[model samples]
Target: MTTTINANSHKSLIRNKVWSRLRAVALPDSRFHHDYSSFIADFEGSSAATDLLQSLPAYQNAHLIFIAPDNCLQELRYRSLTDGKKVIVTTYGIRRGFWILDPEQIHESQWQMASVLDGMENIGRHMTLADISELPTDIALMVTGTGAINLKGLRFGKGHGYFDLEWAMLYSIGKANQRTQTIAVVHECQVLDEELRGEVWDTGCDFVVTNDKVINVKDASKPSCGILWDKLEDGMLEDIEPLKELEAIKKRSRAG
Candidate 1:
């Protein structure tokens, strides 16, 4: 774990340098101006990557998808909704927790608006783990803004660790598993050739789709144990309501 943390720190330094170069030279347009401390890859040229993801057989067959609330993935969510798939997203900061967006549950006029995270309240239904019914082969496609990712399937999110937390929650509830196919859509510039070591908590994606290429990460291992609450920073439980709920569930299960 110490080694993983150190490696992540080293990777982060390199990522910042790469992201700075990209933001300055590769993406200087007004559309890419985001003021967050975490560098979000400019969404200007991510359409091709989204197109490739849409063409995936797994994506086409998935009825339920959990897409992150990200600027680059807005079009993907829109397309998924249009295809009549059930889309679930995290409420901002998981303050109100997660919600489900089904094209059938929302009015046709609001289908486009449903794709927007801020507009979710107007068109989505708040859902709990119990609300979801498991099918034999449910797919999870995560839309992540990465600093860097390697060929070994190791990936680092924009430093927030929200994606990892979400994966843990889903795995704990049995909604996602080791065999459940997972993929990430990133830009070609974000892919790194270095050997990235995976932490016990980090989930490995089965495939990574870039604007210019498709990488198949064979024999990648995802998290098996679910939430590593011990490793979380203090006050995370108080910050995220869903985590509190999950803790209560875990307690009850253990007590019984």
Candidate 2:
């Protein structure tokens, strides 16, 4: 007899299993930090990365954006080429999951000696905690992810909830759209076939890129709004000061 599992339950099981395995492997030597750099080099060396990077639909007119490292590893490679276009790099702080930085800041930094360090720093400048209302509508965003987590539903980050919060805020203000593509970079090991559990506010990336392939996730049945304000618990809003100050959220609430 075959048993059917509900989407949420299946996701929870997968997350628990995946997290346990990942934590075990990821905690050993922090080798992921350097290993990912080699992964990037291999990716760049292959036709897959070259073809995908060159064929991105958003490459023609993106002005502002966010990009992240594949998995939790800091590969330190600049996948997004500005080509003189305005670009922003999303990064993580010592205490936060991700933040935005300007490209120019990385270009002028001392860390530029190593190609990987230079790439990471350059992408750091576009990092910002600003609300979707504060960003340009024409902006394009690329978020990295390890395929290990089930993305069809809500998947937990290492610890911080910044990725969900940031994506949720953008969706709340109607800033996330076709023009705004959320891309995930990952290795083959990280990819999963199961749908994860999702809350009302859960958001999924629009694309998944890897050394071997690129998967378009726009058709996936996940959260569309990105942000589900009503589902947020009490005191949650107080945790992130920047979210409170977002002009769009405040403006809409005042008008209501």
Candidate 3:
């Protein structure tokens, strides 16, 4: 019998190696940060944000942006709000779902504070996927995270599938399209040397910015439509309230 190395097995090996390396370097300590979370490693998130802002004019031009709420991305979120861009932030683990933040909604003094998880609750306008589905806002840019990524634009989150699910939800509601630009910020060490075998349901980023360089991914393929219900396992939606609500909304729309 011949043994075959499938995509899943290959991805698992890569993920394990990356996570191991990240753990060794990124664990919270004096060098990283006093308040570092597990998700944050040795990545210089603030430096990378400065590089992204300088290299890409999109940050300056974007009227609306969707950025993840992670320790590394806090500065980027702050800059986005400070620039007066309408920002969309996800509630941690989607417990309560998305927040649409306009700088004008919060007092000018609180914009910087609202960039983090705790402050966002008070300063941002929290909304459900159902509420956003009814709105007419367009996201010009999306900033995402990765435990590890490759030059081919393949990326995996910290085991949990929040970013992918968020993308699927937005795509399903006619929010994300071909023109939607996704960017990932990571440390130079997080960029892999080879291409990754990606699954159909796995989305790709259009650009990856590291502290050292800005990579423009060519031929990156992202999901053009909504959730891949068939790809989801049983009880997946049961664990996620936002997903359940979005599914219900999708079903009602289909029925009508």
Candidate 4:
């Protein structure tokens, strides 16, 4: 059965639907066990995060981007690299706005110390800036949950739309590619086979990492521009102010 939805409505609908299912499965006393410390220990106790880190091609590159945890649970803590390498970590401020943390200023103590499972001490974490234009095009940034909302698809987030907007910005500028592999770290339980509905602005990830595995989701046929621009409706662009600001869209509408 085919389902149709407006672009603006997509975010709220998908978020509500996905979070409803996730809260049922991931909340306190759930089957998966919602203990943050235990979950971190489990991932660190085993070869999960370390193994996943080692397997990525972008890891060899110096600069990297990581996300901050929302609930003080299941977060990666990074230490300075011995080679004096720089890293960029994307963290969110209150109200779901994006901000970049400077590596040099990480010691200010304003940011809470993230609990480490293991091996996180060896890595470094720098907060990312709100402006995507400030980011280096060459660095690789990792995101959670395939960077998109999925009703039953693998690794859904807790329903905040920040990750999707960040990824969509990168894709819009043609900056997310092999050099920049967007990765998602999730539990095996969050992974699902259900096909997710995506609008033009939604972005997908390059790889997904779980406690036991890493799966690549790149589709060669889909190309870097996954969704066809022509398929986007006029009202959809108006709904997302950022899209309306893009030169391509402005030029297209003028030509039409």
Instruction: Give the per-residue lDDT of model 3 (tens digit) for 41-148.
Output: 435454655556546876777788888766567778877777888888887666568898888778778887888778898888877776767767667788876778
Error of 2 at 217 (Å): 3.0
- List per-candidate RMSD values in Å: 2.8, 6.6, 3.6, 8.3
- Candidate 4 lDDT, 104-182, residue by residue in tens: 6444342334323222232323222325555665446554532222322233343334455545545555555545556
Scored by TM-score, the top model is 1
Name the better of 3 and 4 by lDDT.
Answer: 3
Alpha-carbon shift of residue 50 in model 2 (angstroms): 8.8
Model 4's lDDT to the true fold? 0.43
Off by over 4 Å in 3: 1-5, 24-42, 233-235
lDDT tens digits by residue: candidate 1, 138-237? 5455555555578877776666677788888888888877756777777776777877666778877778888887789898777887888887877788
Better of 1 and 4 by lDDT: 1
Model 1, position 173, has a per-residue lDDT of: 82
Model 4, which residues run further than 4 Å from truth?
Answer: 5-47, 66-74, 79-97, 102-132, 135-137, 145-160, 171-179, 220-256
**lDDT score at residue 250, model 2, on the 0-100 scale:** 70
Q: What clash count does candidate 4 reach? A: 10
Query: Tens-digit lDDT track for model 2 on 108-196?
Result: 44233312433444344423345435755545654545424444423434323455666655555565554566665544445577644
TM-score of each candidate? Answer: 0.89, 0.60, 0.86, 0.53
